[model samples]
Target: ANRLLKALFLVKYVDTFKATPRNLTVLVYDRFGLDLTGLGKQVQEALNLLEAQSYVQRNGNVYEYLTNEEQEIEKEIKAVDVDSAEVSSKLFRYLSSDILKTNKLKYAKNGQDFSFGYKLDDVPQGNQRELTIHFITPETSYSDSEIAAQSMGRDELRVFLGRDKRLLADLRLLLKTERYTKQRTNSGATPSMQAILQSKQVLNADREKELIERLRQAVGKAQLIINAAEIPSSSQDAVTRVSDGFQELVSRTHTNLGLLGGKVYPEQQVAGAVQSETGLFDAATLSALNSPGTEMESWIITQTGLGEKVTIKKIVDRFETKPYGWDLGSIEVVLGWLVGNGKVALSVDSNPVVRTEVTDLIRNTGKHPHVVVAPQKAYDHAKVAAFKKFCTDFFDEGAVPSDPTELARFGKDKLAARRDELNALVSSSRYPFVSQLAGVVALLDEVVGKQVDWYLTDFNKADELLEAKEDLIDPIKSFLNGQQAKIFDETQALLNTNAGNLGYLPTGSADTVKALLADANAFRGNKMNQLKTAADTLRGQIDDIVTDKRAEVTAAIDDRRAEILGSTYYANATPAAQESAIRRIDSILARLGGETQAALILQTGATFEQDDYPELLSRLVEAQQGGDDDAPPPKPMVSVKSISVPDASGVLESQADVDTYLAKYRAALVATLNDGKRITL
Candidate 1:
C-alpha cells in the first residue's frame, strides 16, 4: 500500500513540476486513468500519505507540488503494485470528498463522465499571465464552458480530447508496467519518472511565424498611435521626432511588460523599418550630418588665418546660404557638437566659454559667440613648450609648465615676479634710475599684471601676446642689465675730473663725490637717464666747490704778500733788505702757482701770522752792509779816533747826570773837531 501511494504521488509530482497549479481530478485522470472509480478511496489515502511526507500541499481538491529534491522521493518509492485497485479507490475518494466540501464547486463535461472543478488556492495573484492560444479549428469565439471557466478568475480553456479512452488507459498501464519491470530488474529501485514525463514545448516553424506576425501587428498599432499625435510627416526633422517618439513608446512598453516577468521583445526591427523608410538611421546619414563640424573647424582655421573674426551668426549665415543650406537650428546643433567635442572653440566678448557655459551660449542665439579652431593636442603641447622656453630665455628659468592651465599659471607667476622686481627697483632710494622706468612698469601692469583674464582664456593668442610682451620689455631689461655699473662709472669719472681740478686742497675735499660714486655702485634700478642726470649735477657741484677752494687759496696768498710788503719792519729796512724781502715774497707767490699750491698754502697760511719778519729784516740788512769777507773796510771822511765821555764822579750816577756829562763832552769835542772831525760811538 505504501509503494502504491508513493507511485501515485510521484506521478502527480511529475505533472506539476513546473509549478503549474492543478486540482486532484486533472492530476489523477490525466496521468493515471479516469476509469479508476473504484480506486477513489485508495487515491485519497495515497494523497494523504504524500501530504504527510511534506511532498505536496492539498487545498481542498487542489494540490501543489512542494518538494524540490525529486531524487529523495524516487529513493523512497522503491516499488509499486501495478494492479492495486484498492489504493486507487482510496485516492479517488479523498479527492472527491475535498471537492464536495467547497461551497462554489462546479463540474465540467469530460466525454461521458463529469470532471470535478474547484478553485486553485495557490494560484498567483496581482499581475495576470498573458497567453495566446492557437486553435486547430476556425472558431471565431469561445464556448459557454470556456467563458464560464475564464469567469472563475482562472485562465482556463476547454478543449476536446481526441484520443480514445482505451488507448489512454493502455498508455497508463504501459507506464505502470514499465515502472514495475524497471523496479524488479533493478532490485526494487524505481526508475526516474521525471525523465519520462518531463517534456519541452517547442514551437515549430509555423507557430514561430505566426507569433512573429502577431508581434508585428502589435508594433504597428503602437506606431499608428504615435503617428496620430499630429507630428510632422516629412523631412529629416520629422523623422527625428518620430524616431524619438517611437523609442519612448518602446521603452514604456518594455517597462510595463517586464513587470509580469515576460521577456522583452526586440523593437529594433520595427525601429529599423521606420528609419529605413526615411534613410535617417544609416551610418552614412549620421556621418554626413556630423561632417559639417569638421568643415566648420577648417573654415574657422582659414578665417583665423585671414584675420577675420568668425562669429556664430556668420557661421549660420554662411551655411544657410551656400550649397549646404542648413537651417539655423541645425547649424546651431552642429556648432554645439563641434564645441562640445573640442573641435572648435567658442567665446563671447573675447572670453572663452567653459563647458557648463557652452549650452547657454549656443541656445541664446543673441550672444553671437566667436568661434576659433580648438588647439590640437600636439599644438597645445608645442605651445606650452614654446612658452616655457620663452620664460626661461627672457624671464625665469624655472618656469616650465606641463599643460595649458599650468602654462597660463606659470606665465602669470613669472610676469608677477618681474613686476615685483621692477617695483622694488623703482621704490628703492639707493638707485637713481627709478624715475626713468615709469613707462616700462606701466606697460607691464597693463599687459600682464592687470590683464589676468587674458592669460587665463586666450590660449590661441598666447604666442602672439608673449612676443609682444618681449618686445616691450627688451629695452628695460637691457637698461637694467649693467645699469649699476654704468652709473658707477659715470659717477667715478665725474669725481675724478673734479678732484683733479681741485688741485689737492685737503684730504676730505672729494668726500661728496665719493659718496655719490658709492650710491651709484650700490644702485639697483633701471632709470639710466635719471642716474646720469644726477651724475652730471654732482659733477657740476664738484666743479663749483673746486673753484671756490682755488679762489680762496689764491686770495689768502695775495693777502699774505700785501701784509709783508706794508709792514713797518720792511719799510725801515735798508734798500738791500727791502729788495731781499721783495724777492722772498715773489718766490712765495711763484710757489703758490704750483699744482699742490692750495694744500701748500693751507699749510703755509697756518704759520703765516707767526713769521719773525723783524728778525729776518735785521739779517738781510747786516748781510747787505758787511759785503764780501775778502773786501777792505771803507775809510771814514773825518778819520776821528775813539772819544769817551764819563760821569762827573767817574761813575754813571743817574741817567740825567750821564746825559749832562755826555753833552759837555760832545760840545768840547765838537769845538775841538770843528775842522770836520767824524764822531763814532
Candidate 2:
C-alpha cells in the first residue's frame, strides 16, 4: 500500500487544476493505463488511507496533498535517542538547531545507534527532514564530533543550491527546458489543432467550388505548431498568463471560423443569413420604406406585384443589408405598420397574405439581375467612438458602487443585452474591430473582480481587529501578586499585635474582653473594605491596559502596512512584481502574528524564551555575542560511525521469523525512546 501510494504521489507535482479526486483518477488511468477493472475502488481506498494517515486532506471532491506536513510530523514522532545523559544533551542541542517547534520534541532509544531527530520546516515542502545526531559512547567505540559533522554535511547539496548562484542558474535553465518539453507533450500541441478539427470546414455548396478546393488544399498542407511556451513554474502568474494567451487564441479562432466563414468567402455573401420564413411583413405604410434604398418599395413589389411568390426569408435577403442580415423581428414590425396604415392591400389566398401596394412598385434593375441596388447603409461609426469614450470614462472615475454585487450584476445584465449585438458584429467580416471591444470588456471584468476581492479582504481584516477579544494578563497578574504579598504581611502583623495585647489583658474583666472584641472586629472590617476598593481599582486598570495594548498592536500593524503600500518601488512595480510584493507582505503578516502571540504569552506570565527563535538566537549568540562575523564556525558535538536500515528480508519468510524480528526491533526502539535525556542549562 505504501509503495502504491508513493507511486501516486506524482499527481501532486502535475500542472493540473485542483488535483481533485476525479482528476486524480483520470491521471492514474491516463499515465499508467492500468487495467481499471476495479481500479477506481482501489484509488478511493488509497485516498482513504492517505487521508486517515493525515498525508492529504479531501474537502468534498478536492484533495490537497499534505506530504510535507506529514513527513515533518512523522520525523518528530519517531525521534529516538540513546547513550549517556551527557551525550544525549549534546545531541539535543545539535537537533534544536534544525527544528523550529520546540514543543514537538520527543525522546526515544534504540540499541547501538544512539540518535536524536528533529523536523526542519523552513522551506515550502518538507525537503529537509529529520536532522539526527548520533552519539559515540565507550561501548560503541566511535567518535562523537565526526558523526555530528557527517549529519550536517548530509544537507550540503541543498545548501549549495541555495548559496551558489552560477550553479543555481544552470539548474534553473535545465529545469525550465525540461518542464517546457513535458508541458508541450502533455498539451498534445503537435498537430493537435488539426486533429481537433478532423478536416471539418464551413465551406458548403454555396461557396465558390474552386476557392473552396483551394482553401481545403491550403489547410491540408498547413503545418500547425501550437507551441507550449517555456515559462518558469516558480512564477505561477507567468505560467497562467501564457496559458490564458493560448486559450484566447483558440477561442478567437473558433469564433471567427464558426460564425463568419460565409462572410469571409464573398461568393457565399448571403450564407451567414438565417433562413427564417416565420416573420410577417407589409412594406407599403412603414416610415422606414420612405427612408432610403426603396426598401419598402422593393418588399411591396416582391410580395404582390410582378415579382414571383416570395417567402419572408427571400424578402429579407433582397431588401435588408447583405452578407449579415438584420434582426427578423424588427423587420416584422415595419411590415405590420404598413398593413395597418392601409397603404397596401393584403391578398388572403396565400399562406403569407400577399401585400399589393396602392401604386405599382417597380425596381429599376435594367437587364442585370445583379445590379448595384442601393448604396450600403452607412452606420454611425460615432456609436463605436462613443463606446470607447464610455469605457475610458468609467475606468477613470474609479468610484466603486456601494454594493459589491451591484457592479457584477450590472456588467452581467449589460453583457447579456449586448451579446447578440456582439455576435452579429463579429460574424460580419466587415466589422473586424469588434475583437478589440471584446478584449476591452474581458479585461474590465477581470480588473473589477480583483478590485472587489481586495476591498473585501481589507474590510474583513479591519472587522477582525475590531471584534477580537484579548486578555489583560500582565496587569491582572501583577495586581493579584501585589495584593497577596501585602495581605500576607498585614495578617502576620495583626496576629503578632493581637497575641501581645491578649497577653497583657485581664482574663476575668468582661468590659476589657468586650472592648478587645470590638477593636478586633473594626480592624478586620476596615482592612476588608480597603482590599475591596483596591481590587476594584486594579480590575479597572487591567481593562484599560487591555484596551490600550489592543490599540497599540492595531496601530503598529496599520503603520507597517501603510509604509509598505506607500513605497515608491511598490507603486512602480509591474503586475508580476506586485504579486511578489504581496507574498513578502504575507511573510510580514506571519511575523506580526508570531509577535502578537508572544506578547500575549508574556502578558499571561508564561515564559517566552528567546531560544524559540533559532535565527534570532543565532544572531544574538553567534554574531553579536560571539564577537565577529569572521569567527570560526562551531565544531560538531557528536559524530556518527555508520547509519543503516535494518534488513528484514531474510527473516520475513515465515510468520515466526517476522514476529521475532519485529519483537527485537520494537525492544530496541522502546529503549532508545524511553532512555532519552532532556537538555538542561
lDDT scores of the candidates, listed in order = 0.45, 0.34
Q: Please estimate how well model 2 matches the true structure, expressed as its whole-model Cα lDDT.
A: 0.34
lDDT of 1: 0.45
Pick out the ten consecutive residues of candidate 2 with the lowest summed lDDT. 106-115
Q: How many residue pairs clash in each candidate at the backbone level?
A: 18, 14
- Give one digit per residue, the lDDT tens place, for model 2 in 1-681: 353465457665665566655556665675565767577777778887876675764433455565664444323322322223433333234323322223222211101111123222112222232222121222222233332343332311111001222222222222333333344446655474323222112111112233223323322222111221211222123223222332322332223222221211111211111111122322332233333223453555655555455433444454333222222333333333333333332231321122222111211112123211121122244433333333234323343222222233343334344444434544552312233334433433433433322322321222221121112212222323565335434533443434423332245322332333233222222444454444344334444444454455545545544654575434554555555555654554455444423246233221112122122222222222323577665321111111122564454788888788877666655444354411111
Query: Residues 75-123, candidate 1, lDDT per residue (tens digit)?
Result: 3432344553432332223222421222121111111111223222122
Maximum-TM-score candidate: 1
Score every model by TM-score: 0.24, 0.13
